[model samples]
Target: MTGASAFPRWILPVMSAIAAGVMLALPYNYAGLYPLTWLAFVPLLVAAHGRSAAAHYWLGLLTGLAMYLVATPWMVEFLQRLKDYSLAPALAGAMVFWFLTAQLPAFLMLCWHLCQRFCGHYCLWFFPVLLMVFYGWFPVLFPLQLGESQSAFLPAIQAASLTGVYGVDLMIGISNALVTAGALQAMGWLPGARHTSGVMGGAGVLVLAAWLGYGWWALDHWDRQVSQWPTLSAGLVQSNETPSAAVPAPEPGYSRSWPPEMALSSQLARAGAEVIIWPETRYKGYFEVDQVPGAFQRAVAGLGVPLIFHDAEQQGNGGEFREYNSSLFLGPDGALAGRYRKHRLVAFGETLPLSREFPWLVNWASDYLGDFFANLTPGNDRVTFPVGGVHLVPAICYESAFPGHVARSVGAAPGSPLLVVLSNNGWFGDSRQPWQHASATVLRAVENRVSLVHVMNNGPSTVVSPSGRVLASTPFQERIGLVTDVPYTPAGQVFRSWFTQWPEWFAVVLGLAGLMALLLIRLTRRQA
Candidate 1:
């Protein structure tokens, strides 16, 4: 602790927070810096060494705040656009979200400090295990796991196929923890065996090498396997229109006025697209299942191709009426083929947490925030749509972030279904939000060994191969149609990834092992 006081007491923590924040944020903003994430936590870890639990907690919170602010400056704009909040209120709301997210890191630091106190230098081995458990189970508004930062690194990320993102997270955490231990030992802050830094550094290098080797082999194997699967030409349309909830739906029996997306769909259909996909909730109206809208029916018929798009749907009588964010499929004949309601709804944006139980909170919050808050009801079924001899599993917006949910959806459907993620990123406009959102698709594709097509209202719309390769992508805020040949398992051929079979297995094992180790440590100390 004395050696750590070379500078002012606050200087190391502040500097370490800045360094870790920038390193972590850079990968999300610029994909090429993904490798920086391998050591991103080192600065914070090193600075936290020999610190009190309270100090570690504050350092972790500061680092988390810096990371969020640097990575998602667009959040303030999102709040402003989403609720029409003024500058002050929007900034305040953004800070609230930052503070809430900071708790995860704060808890991690506190737990790490306690482990160090009990286990001494052996805490290095437990650090990654603790992180794996936290990242696996800790709930966050947005699940930005450390593994996703390595989404751009296909070789390293291939580990996700076996352990579902937790494996890659564990790998990165181990490297950071080991490096931090080495740095502390070299600085004399940690009294350990001689050449401890060299031993730790060598261990880190070996772990990284094994991780990359496994990734390379898995990528090659999956790539070959996907190549032999049946292929279909699919078209993704990014209309780039920011649809407003305030915009009223056209009256029933209104003229068949086609949106710009219809023209794009027509062009894609003419170019031999078998199925055309659209972003989430682009059609701004209630789509009654029985009473099909003439305009929508005609538009789909005009294309002469299967169409998949998002729309709001209402069901039940007055008192029991509920609305849903849904994905609907239209057959080539322009008839309702299949519909899947969104299962996951965004908090505050789509639904208030306890509004249903309290009911009055909705109205009070709406009046306070100057925004209407009609919560969208969540769907219970994992519905899949059949398209051109292949089934399509749909995930709307935030649902794509959950690996287990997406995997279960794919597993629920017979045969190997293609994952079609429909998202609307217009609220966050021209920022790292879209890119970060899109990065999840890469891991989803790899984790389930399924081809995924992520179509967004604003851009970075992408198509990813089962091997985690970006087959095609569109720039941000562009009105473009990307036509790509998507590969999927042929009908009657079911496929399941190892990770899908046993999701979060790595995290579970690590948690159990950590518990057993702690028990053994306590028993050994008592005996001593």
Candidate 2:
């Protein structure tokens, strides 16, 4: 192939990215309807072939950037719907999305390429390890993480036991790379493929078969495991509220009573929810400190059930003000029992990043930007609330995407409480944001061998089994106050768990070794 005809170098990455965008719809919104998701990143991985190590690195970077932009516009749309009275902070809000999108993918791409080089054909193994570090375990919005696409195939996701959610992701990256490599090799277009199919082609096919088989078994096991759980009562509430300057902003965005105009605790108890969950910010009037009386205490008192209330707390006012985006747990008796201050506050929504260094910019920017910007401070600890014989982990909003957090919480013993997510999706305004968040919750549940029960202010708040089953979901574009039963995930037979995450450290080491191998190959090739 002449230099002029060298595949144009850029086309494959773009095609792959577009494919990725389409593929991303599968995980939660439309899991398994299309075969496209299974092969989305393959084109880009193929694009990595025949390029120098540096070229491969650049390809991965560009591909990742494209992927993020395509997927996370849902997040941008959701955050943007939070209309402000001014436009500076609003503009800053939009800019923040771009900034976050660019930063994360760039870092992820760096790891992707490093894995490709060091892990070589083992890209699948190393790629996920790096992805978890930069995306899963690390703190970030990650609203559109890739793992959500596998929601259609719970058995496939079953491997999460050993590898964690990162395993599912690793499988995706590896599958993409292998498919791309195989297709190119088959067409006799890849380097050395025309001369020798015995090595590359056989290796690619073998890996593909093994993963496919494993995915099948995982799916089977997942279905069986899911069948064993006793369905418990579950209720996800959608208050259908939004942030608006014209509406007096509710002092805090959420109060126990707002839109839908009902007593949250009363409605929840009447519905007979063994565990009742309110959407994020549903209790913005609640507080962590004394001078401020908790909002839900009175409303929930004597309900004889545990309730999860999302709210915002004011530390003080007038020059001494501090903010916390918090989730409060109230006993059936109407007393605050446990609290989890949101750990991953939205940069433009809840609080601004490094506001002290850029106070003027933030203060001016938030008028139109988003809520409580001064971005609320994150909680320093994780709390598991006691809810009727379960030790439920409280994850406010974005924290549901992190596997390590959920896994640690589930380590409480056999039959721990399911992961509970409380979120306010009104800011996303019926966009794909709620769906995106819903998608990530599955990875967390399946990864940690627990169930996840979520309540969102908008639609898509729902329940998922440890095997990735969506037992129930709220209707899209509607408000709901529901109560249903869900199982307390069982802790028997650790036999088939996929991601145990026991291999994360090893994956990391292997990835680094791959990087070193690439450097050595380049040096030796140059010397020759």
User: Which of the numbered candidates is closest to the native, going by highest TM-score?
Assistant: 1
Q: Across residues 275-341, which tens digit of lDDT does each residue of candidate 2 receive? A: 6777765345445434334444555565677777766767788788777777777777767777877
Residue 262 alpha-carbon offset, candidate 2, angstroms: 4.7
lDDT string for model 1 (134-219, tens) is: 77777788778878877789998887878888888889888887777768777888675446556756877898799999889988
In candidate 2, which residue ranges exceed 4 Å CA deviation?
1-29, 46-70, 85-143, 187-208, 222-231, 245-268, 288-298, 316-322, 356-371, 412-415, 490-510, 516-528
How many steric overlaps does candidate 2 have?
50
Q: Give one clash count per candidate, in the order shown.
A: 0, 50
